[model samples]
Target: MTFFDEMKTTFKDIPRPEGEISTLEFLEASESLVKLFDLFGSSAFSVVQNDMKGNINKVSTKFLSDPINCNTLQKLILLEIKENGKKVATQGLLWLCRGLQFTANAMRKCIDNKDWELSKCFEKSYSETLTKYHSMLIRPVFKLAMKACPYRKDLFVKLGDDLNKVNEQLEDWVAGLEEIVDVIMKFFESGNYGKGL
Candidate 1:
């Protein structure tokens, strides 16, 4: 399998017990993940944007939902990188980061400025859901992004920070961040932690 596949397997299988993953090993793995996600992000956004240039609501509900169709776009990104050059790959990935930052900022604005309870509730729900399901997904992505976007400290930090914000919002969001290797630790019962992973 390719590195991304290796990553998927690593992501799916829980991290080892007790011992910490070597910081260097983690950093290298993080680089690959960032590069790949960047690639995935650029292509996916481009395709979706072009396909729905005039219909953004449709785009969100259709192409960009969670557990979305990014899988295929991800593969395309990896394949292109494998076949092309690193420069091309990096460019694509950078674009992806920009897109993510834009969306995240917009989401933040919407969260802060709500005219209705429903809007606030929707923001709360989305944040909680992603915070619940996506800690595993977002951490490595952030680590990778940090490596990739060294100059853009704000974006990297903000994105990384987001992985933790939801649980804080819910209080349950750490009442989370307390799991074994899991980013958000699920509270099962007293003294027993259930991992969101």
Candidate 2:
């Protein structure tokens, strides 16, 4: 099976919610995000702002409901990134991070409003998606990006720090990423990656 087929088999199996934004929708959005990353493989990683916004909107709206405006949530994430985001040679990286932030925010909103089933479904799909990302997507891209830039920028750290100023839901997300950061730091400390940048 193809990668997308595998992704669909894994994520689309998630039990559906009662809204437009189903677990399948989120999974599709994640798959789209990975497609955006694939552009990097062809050295075509630039993003036109309008297209980026449209793509994010398309994904965010999949299961949207009252008080859960995908556009607003996406805008909030972009705003945070614009205010405190860093520059990377690849624009897909920024989009990927922002998309994940938006997904996390949407799930948090579900959890906050006591939509237990949908929230739990989102958590399951997201966890699986992230696992695929780390193993199938991020590792190769990270190696390539590190080679081209040779400097690692923790977008999550910068994002978490900024989001902390205005959003509380990210506390756990940031904490999780920070733990990952600690491991990366240890890897760097081992001098296997040629000193910290």
Candidate 3:
């Protein structure tokens, strides 16, 4: 299927949550997000570790050594895109992963802030960016990933299991991030962020 078709297929499964959020909801969301972030970090590390035969470490090193303001994760996405000339699915997924990592880091910082109101504002921006990236990039790439690696009863089942775990972890992270964003929006709407602590 074409990228557009794949994106449509992907979106069909995602529920579009609507309506306003409250401060209690936002706090709960943030807590869940923090837990997801921790889980995502571990999952990401596992992927890197499993790449013993691959060049993820080299790519990571190059990214860290680069003078750009962007982090190593961002550089990894760029490297993947550049290297995966014909692997559109891999390229797309890498970019989406980069966006996830970026959002996770941003949320971590926001959650650390002493000023709840400012943190909520920052979270709002991060959530908006994440939503755009997920819809425009992640869905199609994910389709590509599944297509590239068709399920088979082969000896390399372990590899497939690892990939599945990574994918599952990513989905969980996205869900947690969305929850936090919903709460942040509610906090702003209720003017709770502006109130004295």
Candidate 4:
């Protein structure tokens, strides 16, 4: 089976009604997406994986603390704002969305440009999505990871035997991820939750 098929929670399954993303499912799907780094078969990707994991844990902890009030991601951040104004989970969710956007953009590039290498796709996506947020010191590390991407054909082969099927699944998965990131970003923009983040 493909990695997407094996995921416990695919982005396509996550609920986002009225632009409110469900917290538990999004966290679960984020966790599953982090595993995609493993498929790259390069230690350099550990940096990306760890960063995503840390943010996911932050949000998940808050959700577990009060699932009733934090049913939707919007509610989670709103309640956090109301209770403490600390915005720990809010910041974490923001970073997590950025990471997800980076991944989705990279995958979309790969799917859209048949001639492009994995390294090129990842580097281009990183430049557009996460470069500004990363510190100067952190940028080189991520750059190295992008350069360490496995050969496009090799990675695609590992994804599944049928390239067409893999591309189709990846396109749908990336589309779902992009939609989630867009919704969360718009919410953040509306509330200025990302003001100091």
Candidate 5:
């Protein structure tokens, strides 16, 4: 299928078959999915001015607002669009982001509800998506950002060190969520997701 076709195929609102993993790999994979989702979802909190909300709020009042599809995510994503992607139409990217954001929401729901049973299917699909995204999206964007962005070596200069700081903070927050997913996945893969299971 063409890239556009693949993109269209990815973001359907189909509900995944949710259930616990009978294998250890299932648990680890589940965690990987959640981690990837958080990493991607975090863009909303980092780039968008008003969007923020994650479990990190369990501690402080930092990212309690919803940042889904806010300005920041749109800006960088737009800035990083490729030539082939350029002709894909604006709605294409919007759909892509919405689809990704929707997946992120599902991962977050699993985390919030502590639904280990359904997490198994989520783990498998999520890991695959992350791998595909890294190859097709994230890696390409970084390469383009470093070489293609007009700022080049000086991109961070005008943005200030605070940009990196914010990015780091976002990473740290998402890392925690990832750790939980990883542990959960590992547990089920090992047949022990719960403290004693």
Candidate 6:
């Protein structure tokens, strides 16, 4: 089976009808995505993995506190805002979405440009998705992780023996993730939930 197939919660399985993503499912999928960093086989990616994991845990903790009200991502943030007037989980979700976007964009670049190495794809995606949000010190750290990415072919081969099948699954997975990211970004922007975040 391909890596996507093996994932307990691929983006495809996350329910996002009308752009309202299920809270627990989305967190589960984000947790699964963090595992992808392991394929790089470098300590540098631990920074990326841990960042994503921390945000996922923040959101998960909030959701677990009140699953009935926080069933959907939007509701979770809105409820948090109403009760605490704080944006802890909201900010976490914003950064988590950005991280997912970075990963999706990098994978999309890999699918679009066969000549680019994984490092190049990651760097390009990082610039496009996360660069503006990162401070100078943080930017260099993420850059180091991007530069430490595994070779393209080596990573894909580890996914599955069939390159074509792996690419197809990856494309679908990235597409699903991109759609959800776009939805959350727009939601945050429209509601001004990301203000000062």
TM-scores of the candidates are: 0.23, 0.21, 0.23, 0.97, 0.22, 0.97
Candidate 1: tens digits of C-alpha lDDT, residues 1-197: 22233342222233433332222222233333334334333343333233222222322222233222222223223343455544232233323333333333333443445443322432443354333433576544433322332222233343345534532342321121122213211112222321121
Q: Write the per-residue lDDT of candidate 6 for residues 36-142, one digit (tens) a residue.
A: 88878999999999999999988998999999999999999899889976778998999999999999999999999999999999999999999999999899999
Q: Which stretches of candidate 6 lie over 4 Å from their true place?
A: 17-19
Backbone clashes in model 2, listed as residue pairs: 20-62, 20-63, 21-62, 21-63
Global lDDT of each model? 0.31, 0.36, 0.35, 0.92, 0.30, 0.91
Candidate 2's displacement at residue 42, Å, is: 30
Prediction RMSDs, each to the true structure: 18.6, 19.8, 19.2, 1.0, 19.9, 1.1
What's the lDDT for residue 186 in model 3?
47
Q: By how many angstroms RMSD does model 4 differ from the true structure? A: 1.0
- How many clashing pairs in candidate 5? 20
Model 5 Cα lDDT, one tens digit per residue, 18-126: 3221222222222233333232323422321121122212111211122232222222233223333332222332323323343444344434444333234234334
Candidate achieving the largest lDDT: 4
- Write the number of the candidate with greater lDDT, choosing between 5 and 6: 6
TM accuracy, model 1? 0.23
Local accuracy of candidate 2 as per-residue lDDT tens digits, 1-197: 22232333222232334322233344354454344234223342232223345544543443243224322323333333455543221133234444455344434543364434432433453444433435565445433432331111222232234433423433443343333324323433453331211
Model 3 agreement with the true structure over 86-153: per-residue lDDT tens digits: 43322332333333344454434434543444235334544555445455654454333223322222
TM-score winner between 2 and 5, please give it: 5
CA deviation > 4 Å runs, candidate 5: 1-89, 119-197
Error of 5 at 17 (Å): 40
Say which prediction, candidate 4 or candidate 5, comes out ahead on lDDT. 4
